[model samples]
Target: MSTTKIGWIGLGTMGIPMSQQLISAGYPVTVYNRSKDKEATLKKQGADTAATPAALFQQTDVMIIMVTDDNAINEIFTGKEGLLSAGVNGKIIINMSTVSPSISKEMAALCKEQGNRYLDAPVSGSVKQAETAQLVIMAGGDAAIFEQVKPVLDKMSKMATHVGDVGAGNVAKLAINTLLSIHTQGLAEAVLLAKQNGIEAATLMELLNNGALASPYMKIKGDAILADNYKAAFSLKNIAKDLRLSKDIGLSTPIGEAALKTFGAAEHEFGNDDLIAVKKYLDK
Candidate 1:
């Protein structure tokens, strides 16, 4: 294997495709996932599998984590003979999970103390973007460290920008996701309004798609709403989680608080389904 071989832990919807890109790029990628069935495709695509995260880490110079949330990141880092056991000296851990800033700071401090470098790079793109390596990457960490890992990150993202210190990436991601909450929730509400007034949801969405109000994301969300297919492009459960986390930033901001409640209502109405169903709550 090349010394530049990459180790990837996590092979879900986005992670699988993203890792495939690296493997096809000639970076020997060793993947570790709790469920082995999902990775059959990756194996066929010229990737190897490790029995454990530590074993995977042992094979690569850089480790990329693309889990669901902070808890998962923690479990992976602190898993039996995990990242810490691998001893990250001369290695960099690029955390691509969308997690809380406090958690990022904690991870950063831990990595620094152990002579490992950490980068908080929360991505802003869906599965499609991950497959195409067209993701917009917002990264925060040391400039020197970023440059060291730039080539690898470049393989996964179309545009990678360093935001600030280690935890700042999450801060920027939080702000961006905040606007997304507003747009997603607001679009849901508008669709609900049309439905309640006896307008065809599909027809209205078609008009919106061709009108000035259309956004690509909105069209996606609208189609899901029309089909009642909330299959987790982004989970509503996570939307509620993000709003709940954002609420802690500033409760006095009534707008954000309203959004928090709005998404909360969506969670209640949709039963922790696909997040795009936030529109159904508005309809109810």
Candidate 2:
């Protein structure tokens, strides 16, 4: 493995734990978040901090971003004092944000023009998975670059796969999340039906857990919903965003469209809560 310094941008639910995995693996990591408060926590955990993205980029050859959306990505990468303002020769930039495929392609082209490699490497899994380094990372980039970064990626992901060239990662992510959103909503409805028909929510979930329909998502999220614990593994609003993305990506997804409406309502009511809160919309 090359002694390349790792730079992390973003410290939200997923980013914090993912970065910590790299640090715990003994990588020299420098982190930057728009909100500087979390930087102190990460700094105490053996990671370095920079006041700006440009400053962070100045000190590292490999940068990983896990910000919220395209707007955040634009501001952090193209705004004043952004990464592009810094010299980027021989740098590898991996964007793990859940943005549109087009933007990833554009970012990759721009970085290529500046003699840097860029990868759209969004992840699948919730915060718990992130903390446990069990994320499934879908990467889209040059295969050589993907190979070079696989070791570092493995520190944060149980599976890191190069799906294809630029834009493919987000495309793959959108497709996956379409099923996720619909399935989550379906789970919500099942809980609602169980509760409404006098069957205990816990019993229904227990039966589902033993059946072929159960998944890792259902096991964790099902228990959370049964307990009315809305603490987010994945925020309802974020899943709603992904639902909208799936709809907009040129797919005539009627099921996704319906799921989007259900999640959209739940997001409006409990946007910051766990996606399991979509159950709140189910009975009402």
Candidate 3:
């Protein structure tokens, strides 16, 4: 029953659905996006649309940003017409993008200096999970602030946890994405091996799904691979970006190296395709 007005930036796949959850829950929402056309649909659904980030921040108590990367995040929050220009006093900024922990820490510090609260709140899940509000959100920031936003976070995710202090959410996201990359690559390699040895790829997937090897990702993405559906539930290029971020974290990842290379190549060839499309590279 909190009357906090919400602001949303970014209108990409996950951003759209995540914001919809808030709007549907009867929260007053003001939204802004780089492309104004994307606002058309939200505007019709009882959400207010702002012309710029500064304008959106003016009417918002909590702003949820779900942009692509760190660069995009910096652009909207620091320029002449950015969020800071309007003052962030008493505002809570939650960043839910996959980005570097270092950058998240830097933004958190800057927001703190301006008397605002910040959270590094990256999410785990793909398009379907987002649409269903089943994402796992890992948030990092002050414990009190996290408690303040947990209800709002709950409306957008199945589980939202305060993992640690500032920057910890990105760290958790990178580690999770590393494992995601490894699982996807391993699955692709196995399917390719089966196909090459006269075993049907679909058959192998069926067996795997019914056995202890079954995973939510394997079941979902494996079906997509089997049907040759690469409609970008999660793009190969983004996974490559996450893999690069994982490496930059300075963790030793001998297994991830090969998976990264495979995904890097898949990105080079099929950047916009679904991550399951890595199976195509292996099929060749």
Candidate 4:
């Protein structure tokens, strides 16, 4: 069993399984979520629960955050009864949320002011990867602090890479998500074109899966399209948000612009569905 005490914030789709990985690895874990009901699963797995973010900080040495959007990140850190409210020192805070680099830098400054350490460590896999402990973690922060938390991070990921100083992880996450949007949109377009010309969806998926263009993403999402399963593993709305964040960070190429427009249009009806649901939108 590892000796580092971990405090986890946010218990959404990805957070619950990721924290469970640490617990399975035998590190003591304490979790906090705005919705108290979400804490039950981890608590059942021998993990402790905290009433608030500040209270969690007091109980743990390393704090891991995985929430939705920039506003939620801010609320968890600086809102009433937040981590800084605990006035703790030397606590390492790793934010695994997909938020903007600017907000990460701002939070890092605040953490530094309060004599705490901060790392922006956003991940590259969906809920499946998180559940299986196969996530790819791109982290940004002090190199030494990263090494200090590497063992703890290892329990939740296949690899944890320190990309650069604060906010680089957010930049890396946005870049990869941009490509994910383009790739998924392209796959949807290709399938639609083939189906319109009288080719079967299954036939095209088989060809794509066996050809040089194959990938785990293509396989899984293609199967989802075949089964007509539009459940949200990674939602269309979140990708739209990532594209908007990429635009703010100066992603203005022709392909990027088109992808942004395509996803923006799809956000209304299919936003809550899987990103592969772009096929349904385009087929409409």
Candidate 5:
């Protein structure tokens, strides 16, 4: 077993599998989640459980956070019984959540003040990739610190690239998510247009999959669209949140602006569903 003591926060869809990768890789891992029941699966895998974020930090040298939104991120780091509450030092905090760059920078500075290291290391790809240890991690932090954690990160990702200094990963993630929104919206519009003009959904998807626009994402999401399986691998509400976060970070181009409006509107009814559920919203 590896000697690095790791602490994980959050056990959401992506978090559960990603943290499992580390445990399976033989790292000694301890987990903490607000919903205590989520810790059971990890515990069964021989992982330890901590009562709180501060307790988890105290037990481990590295802390990995993968939670929902900026609010949850704030709560994990600063709320009562949070990691910061312990007055720890020489620890590293890796935030793999999709949050604003500003918050990441703030957290990085706060960690520095306490003599701890921080990395904004958000990921691309969804639950499927995470489950299979094929996630692409975009990290921003000190190069040396990134190198130190690369092996641990490798357990969960197919690739982990150090993009820049603190908060750069969040910027890169938001940029990628913005384009993802645009691509998904474009795909939905194309399929809807084809359906309206008397062409079958399968036919257009086949052409798109085989033609110049072909991609793994197109194939996976295309299959989901054809099957009408909008079951939140990556939810509609999250993309809408990413778009809003993008706008706050200065994304105002025409296509991005339109996709923001489109996804924002779709979030009202299909927020909990898969993002491709936008196809249904547009069809209505």
Candidate 6:
């Protein structure tokens, strides 16, 4: 059995719950969140909290990063007194945050120079999935190191795919989210149009459920739209962030540029509410 302890950084909305799944599985986990109050739940689940990212660096065999964006990810691995300072020899760093693929490669290079390993294992699911270990994980890294982390990953995901090397996982995540954004936005739009065109939304939803358009995601979220409930299963702000990252990836392609403009408008219109509220923007 691998006796490696885990060091987790950025225990925010998604991180806290995911770290708990590890602790609940009886793994020795040390966590650091810039904010201390967020550590409460992880602590209850048997995680030892560190006040600063640097303070927790040398404590584990694998360090998992789950912060918000690329900048935060870079700072943790290369910042003043960051992981590089603590030394990463024989250790692995698994980044589960949604970051730009280019940044993932940069970190991979840095880790190689220092004899550490890097895995970009971004997830697709919300806070609720993190709590239940039902998230889908897309990973990119050396296959050997991925095998090493697979045991722990099982505690966090219902499905974990090792996509390829270095930045492939990030690319896969972006693709998945892009398709999800396109589909969800379409579903939300169709529901709105159906209702406004003198159609009973629930009946339309039932037909959708029984017909070629049926998907549990469509049915459930579509119902939320009809009921006008925009609860934040995944916040609009975060999805906007992903869409923005996707836009950055697609910058050289004209079609992608247009899609970026469209999603950006939705983000601007929806602001910080639930992602399902994207329907509001598609409405007009």
Worst 10 residues of 1 by lDDT: 245-254
lDDT on C-alpha atoms for all candidate structures: 0.81, 0.89, 0.89, 0.95, 0.94, 0.82
- Candidate 2 residue-wise lDDT, 1-284, digit = tens: 34779999999999999999999898899999878898988989988888899999989989999998988988887889998889668899999999989888888888888899999999998787899999999999899999999999999989999999998999999999888888888888888887888998899999999999978888988888878899887889999988877777875768878888888877878999888888877767
Q: Write the per-residue lDDT of candidate 3 for residues 17-116, one digit (tens) a residue.
A: 8898898988999999988888987998989998889999888999999988879888888877988888758899999999999888888888888899
Count of residue pairs whose backbone atoms collide, per candidate: 1, 0, 0, 0, 0, 0
- Predict model 6's lDDT versus the native: 0.82
Better of 1 and 4 by TM-score: 4
Better of 5 and 6 by lDDT: 5
Ranking by lDDT: 4, 5, 3, 2, 6, 1
C-alpha positional error of residue 262 in candidate 4 after TM-score superposition, expressed in Å:
1.1
Please give the lDDT score for candidate 4: 0.95
Cα lDDT for residue 50, candidate 2: 88
The TM-score values for the models, in the order shown, are: 0.92, 0.97, 0.97, 0.99, 0.99, 0.91
Clashing pairs in 5: none
The TM-score of candidate 6 is: 0.91
Error of 3 at 217 (Å): 1.2
lDDT of 4 by residue, 186-266 (tens): 999999999999999899999999999999999999999999999999999999999999999999999999999999999
Give every collision pair in model 3. Answer: none
lDDT of 1 at 238: 77
Instruction: Please report the TM-score between candidate 3 and the true structure.
Output: 0.97
Query: Once superposed on the true structure, which residue ranges of model 6 sit more than 4 Å away at CA?
Result: 251-259
Per-residue lDDT of 1-284 in model 5, one digit per residue for the tens? 88999999999999999999998899999999988888998999988999999999998999999998999999999999998999999999999999999999999999999999999999999999999999999999999999999998899999999999998999999999999999999999999899889999899989998999999999999999889899999999999999999999999899999999999999999999999999989989
CA shift of 22, model 4, Å: 0.2
The residue ranges of model 5 lying beyond 4 angstroms of the native Cα positions read none
Q: For candidate 1, what is the TM-score?
A: 0.92
